[model samples]
Target: MKRFASITLRLLISGVLLVLLFREHDLFADIAPRFHSLLTNWHWTLAGMGFAFLSLFLASVRWHIILRGLVPSLPFPMVLQAELISAFFNISSVGVVGGDTYKIMALSRRLPGQTMPVSVSLVLDHLTGLISVAILFTACMLARSSQWNEIGYDMRMLITGYAMYVGGALVGLVISWFSFTPSLLAWGRRTFPRTMGNPKLTGLIARLTQVHAVFALLWRRTISAMAVSTAMHAAFFVSFYCGLRAVGGAAPVLDVLTSMPIVDAAASLPVSISGLGVRERTFEALLAGLAQVPEAVGVSASLAGWIFSLFWGVVGGILFLRAKHAAHIAPEAQCA
Candidate 1:
């Protein structure tokens, strides 16, 4: 029933956005020509796909670094396989929960008795990824502040609010790091005896504490992981920039860098089906409002990005199927 509700919501949001986007323009008239143009520029499309793949690879490497602190012996190939499978699930399902569940289940099967630590590693990897996005978004906004006057007062206010939100999140993380003491866990256990009395809850709290300790121990590597994450995000923005160029849109690099984070953050909300229509509209609004591009060109560029991402999704689907076959064969091989 819950899953049904989720799917319904996704479809509703996607349908509404699709209508809103195409209500004024002739979809066949506007989009078909742009798509034809995009196909003619195969070189840019291929380049964008290459950058997208590079970004995914970098993200897998970043996850491997985080996993090393928990399971040092875990192979890179295994992590890469899991990451690809996760990506497939993320695209197919409504939200990231599907991908995260796949990661946890796959890792648990591979490493018995280590699920707790494996889960911790996944959480930390996600946290670092968010931090990197916040940092990059903030930096791009600052670097492009001179152009803010062109975007109007409303957008300027939105940018200021986003920067403040990111800054507050960073400060909160630092405070949490300092405040994560063993006594905090002890106090929670004592205060909520009934709640913590559940063996599962107690175990989860214990694992969280262990995660905090491990994070402190690997502070240097954590910083390095953030660097790698930033590079991954850079590749992502570059991929979008290349896609935009492919569609004959000459938006500046800083504009792509600044606008995409907002688009991405909006799309990641569980409001639509993989952010299908929401993403396109966001691209249209941001690119048109900030970069003074035509709404049609903005939508075209967004469609190009969607095409590149869908190509990778197809690859991830193949990888996910291959992993299933491998998993099936492993038991037979072990028995033989």
Candidate 2:
């Protein structure tokens, strides 16, 4: 019943977001014009692809670093495959929270005995990435406040509210990090057995402890992974800039680099499925005035980004599947 309710709500939200994204007739008319002009910017288009590939590779490195201690013998290529597969799942889901569960599952299947450690590595990777993104968005919001001021009151308020939310989230994360100890979970189990449910909650509590312990052992590596992830994020923003230029929008590259993360974070809301319509709507809403271009141009830029991501993600998926197949074959061949 609970699962059904959740799926039903997600479907409803997806429908609403799609409507919001496509309801603007003027926007669609602008897309053809924007696409026609932007298609000519082959240089920026290629640059975007390059940056995206670099970003993916860097993300793979981050994962490798995280797993180095736990699964030291695992090949970098295999880890890269996992990263790509994870990204593919994330894009496919388009929900607020996607990919991590799939990623953990994939890693567990591939690494066998290293499942628990790999899962811990992923948790640390995700936590640090989330913190970095929140910090980046907050910084970008503060830096771009002046430009937003020239736009209008509502825009300013929206940015302000978003900043506050990010700020709160960062603080909350810090607090949780400090408070997340084994004792806390034990207390929770005892205090709220009804809410906590059965063995699943108990298992989860044990997993959290194990994750924290593993994290302590790999803190240095985890930090290194986060640094690589940050670089990758920067590369992704640059890709978005190229996409903007491709669409004939003469937006400042720095502005896009600074603003893109927050734009993406906002679009991550459950408003649209797999970020379908939300991506277009977000670009239109934020970039239209700032770039001094038609909303259609912003929409085109967003679509271009989605295109680059999907293409690379597909490449990753092929590699991931190949690696998985090889892993399966290797043991069988040895036995034979």
Candidate 3:
């Protein structure tokens, strides 16, 4: 009942926000024209989807590498299957790993005593994607130069927010590093013996220490995974750029690329289900600010970008159900 209510609330939020966007932007008037544009430029839509899938494939490969650090026997097909399943549920998506709680929990159930290790793997996976976001965002900012002033205050604020988010993540990593270091761990154990006595917390720290070991042991694999993550983000940027073209919008690819990381970050926020209204609103503001893109085109292209995610998510849902029905693989299959 609690879960149901949370879902209901998210649905309400999405509906309210979208309705507001439609009214504010006069999106009602552009609905017919937007559909007409998409129908006519179906090829770009198709290409965008191809890139989205390519991004998915790359994501799977990266996850597979990370898992191999802990679960060496884990198969790539299984990792791919999980990505598809998680994609549909919006627990994870194209470009960003998002909150990988589903994947972590699923893996934890399988690994039993190794829940912490599995969690560490997910952390590493998320870190790879996050580092990529910081890199990509910084690159975009550098590429934008002073013309960035053209995007208006709201857009600049969004960029600033994203920068701060990146900065915070970096700080968090540093703190995590300190906490995990041998000296800090010793200091913590001395300073908080009660916490050290907590089996659960102690075990978690132990698992994190093992993660440190994994990093040392599998540094090459870690690098490979991050490299793949970077390429995956690149694919997502191109795919969204394709969406604008598909919608008959003239937003520059560079500008679209610059804004997309922000769009994805906003969408990844837990506020809206599958980022429905939030994604549209954030992208709409960006396109309007960055390129003077028509509100209709901005919204249309945003939805168009969502289609790639939706398409693969549906495919994943099918695979998920199929695996669920198969008695033999159900236990292992659902872990993905």
Candidate 4:
């Protein structure tokens, strides 16, 4: 029943976005011409795909670094495989949680006794990636503030709020690095003996303290991970720029840098399957409104970008299926 509800919601959101996207323009007429134009500049399309692949490689490397920090003996190849499998699930499933669950389960099976730390690492990895996105968005906004002054009030407010969010995240990371969460837990137990009498609550507090300690231990690695994440996201942005050029769109590189993050964030909201219509519409809006590109060109570039991602998702699907088969055969082989 829950699955049914989720699917229904996803379809509804996708339907609404599709309507919005095609309302002002002819879908077939607009996209077909731009796509045909892309064939003329096929080399740029290949370049975009290369950049997309590089971004995925960097993402796998960043995750491997985080996993290794938790389990020093964790092999890079294994981590990379797990990352690709997760990406497959993320693209194939209804939402991103499916991929995260797959990743945690895969790692937990491989490292039996360290599920808690593995889970913590995954959470930290996501948080750091989010922080990097926020930082990048803020930086780009500031860099183009002069040009953005004429943008709508809503956009200005959104940028300002995002800047505050990035600042808050940075401060939180610093506090967590120097925090005495363990001591705080101890003090809470001492001060609230009655409350601490509940084993479940006590256990929860203990786990939180442990997670916090691990997080602090990983502070240095988090910085490096964020740096890699920034590079990875930049590569993705460059890929989008290449797509725009391939489609003959004249959007500025900085405009793409600043706007793509917003479009990507909106598209990742779990409202539609793999962002689908949401991504196209957001891309169309940002590119047309901010960069003065044609809506058809913007949508075409977005579709091109999606095709690049779909190619990777297909690769990930093959890798995931292979991993599943290997896991299934391992015990049978041992018995034989």
Candidate 5:
């Protein structure tokens, strides 16, 4: 019954999302007629897509660095594979949960004896990445102060909410780090008392501390990771800049850069699966007053981003299936 209810809810969400997406825009007029223009602008789109994927790869590499401290002997390819697989699932209707779980399972399987530590590393990797995004986006907004003032109230609220959420996460991490043993142990015991009863489980829990140690040891590298991510994120903005240009729109690069993170973050609020309706509305609302671009153009650009994300998700699906099949066919040790 619970599974049925969950499925029903997701379907309902998808329906509402579709309505939201097509609500304001004339789907046939705004989207269908734009195909030729999009094709003509394919160069920018392809370039943007390439840069986006490259950024994701770089992120995976940074994640691997964090993982190394947890499971020193784990293969790099294994980590990358897991990340790709996870990212693929994350973009689907299952949302972030499916992807995160897939990632944890991959790490657990690949590192065998280091499951807990690897899990710890994944959490840390996610935390650091979110922090990195916040720092980079904040810098982008500050650099384009004038543009910041022009953003709508809805967007400002969204950005503020995201900032608070990330801030809260950082606070939680600090709290966890300082008082790691009791909170984590209690949580683990409550959730997995049977596992906690095993000696190996105690060792796994201890390994989590080792993972934290790894994070401390590599704290410096996190700066480098954020630096690289900043460059990549800038590259992402450039993609959008070129994309807008390709479509003959007049929005400035700085405007797009400053506005995008907030808009993107806002659309992620589960108001729409894959951010379909929500993204279009946010983009139109945010960009309409600031720039002379048509709502359709902004909507078109958002649609293009959705396309690219779905493409990657499709790739992830293939990997998910491949991993599933390999799990069954391969030796148990090979999974590790």
Candidate 6:
């Protein structure tokens, strides 16, 4: 019942926002026609599609690099297949940890006793992406430093809020990194002796401490993974720009690049289904403030970018089915 209520509320929120967006714009005239232009702008559409796939592929490569560091015998093709299948889950819930959970389960099955290491690798994989996002957003903001006075106060606050969120996330991650260390664990036990006295808490910390060596397996590769992911996210933002051109909307490369990090972060928030209404609103608002672009174009481009991503999600669905079928076939063949 709790999960049902959460889903219902998300559906309601998304429906309400979409209705409000459309009530202010002519759907048949503006949004629908722009979608049709995707076919007309075939060149841009293809470019967008290519970039979208490149982003997904690069992400897989980063994960493969991290996981390979730990399990040197794990084949790249196996890791790549796992990452490709994850896209299906990623699109399904957007912000939920479906893809990550799937990867953990699948890899844990193969590796047996290495669940902690596998989980750590996935966590580090996402950390690299977040670090890249913070870097890219900062660079873009610096490049636009001269236009600070032109941005509205509300917009400035919004950007500042996002900056704080990124900073807080990094801080939390750093604390978590330290928590896996003996020094922080000892400090925690001393700081809150009573709380740390609980049997469950002690057991949990003991388990975590046992896995401390896994960090050594992954720590050095963090830099290399971040380097790869920077290009990965750059491809993703450029894909958004291609989506804008696909819809015949105009915005400078820098403006689109700057606007998308905010859009991506907002869309990753779990309030709405697949960030349906939220993505469109954030994209439209950022472009309007940063580039003086029209709302209609922003909305259309946001939807276009999502649809391009959804294309890969659909492909992943097929791949997932094929993998499942092959699994079944291998069992039957083994019996024969």
Give me the runs in candidate 4 sitting further than 4 Å from their true place: 95-97, 165-180, 191-207, 328-336
| Model 2: lowest-lDDT 10 consecutive positions | 19-28
Number of the top-ranking candidate, with lDDT as the measure: 6
Better of 3 and 6 by TM-score: 6
Indicate which candidate wins on TM-score. 6
Model 1 per-residue lDDT tens digits across residues 263-335: 8877888888878888888888888778888887888788788778777877888988887798899999999
lDDT scores in order: 0.82, 0.73, 0.81, 0.80, 0.69, 0.86
Residue-by-residue lDDT tens digits, candidate 5, 225-320: 667666656665565555565555668766777667667676667544655667677776666755657888887776676666566667878987
Error of 5 at 126 (Å): 1.2
Query: After TM-score superposition, what is the CA distance of residue 118 in candidate 1 from its true location, in Å?
Result: 1.5
Q: How do the residues 158-200 of candidate 4 rate in per-residue lDDT, one tens digit apiece?
A: 6566567667877886676445476765676789889977999
lDDT string, candidate 2, 39-124, tens digits: 58888888888888888889888878878888888889777766777777767663434667776777787778766777778777
Lowest summed lDDT window (length 10), candidate 6: 208-217
User: Residue 179 in candidate 2 has what lDDT?
Assistant: 56
Candidate ordering by TM-score (highest first) = 6, 1, 4, 3, 2, 5
Please state the error at residue 322 of candidate 4 in Å.
2.4
Question: Comparing 1 and 2 by lDDT, which wins?
Answer: 1
Using lDDT as the measure, name the better of candidate 2 and candidate 6. Answer: 6
Better of 1 and 4 by TM-score: 1
Q: Backbone clashes per model, in order?
A: 0, 1, 0, 0, 0, 0
RMSD of each: 2.7, 3.9, 4.5, 2.8, 5.8, 2.3
Badly placed stretches (over 4 Å) of model 1 are 95-97, 184-207, 329-336
Write out the backbone clash pairs for model 2: 94-274
TM-scores, all models, native as reference: 0.90, 0.82, 0.87, 0.88, 0.78, 0.92
> Worst 10-residue stretch by lDDT in candidate 3?
91-100
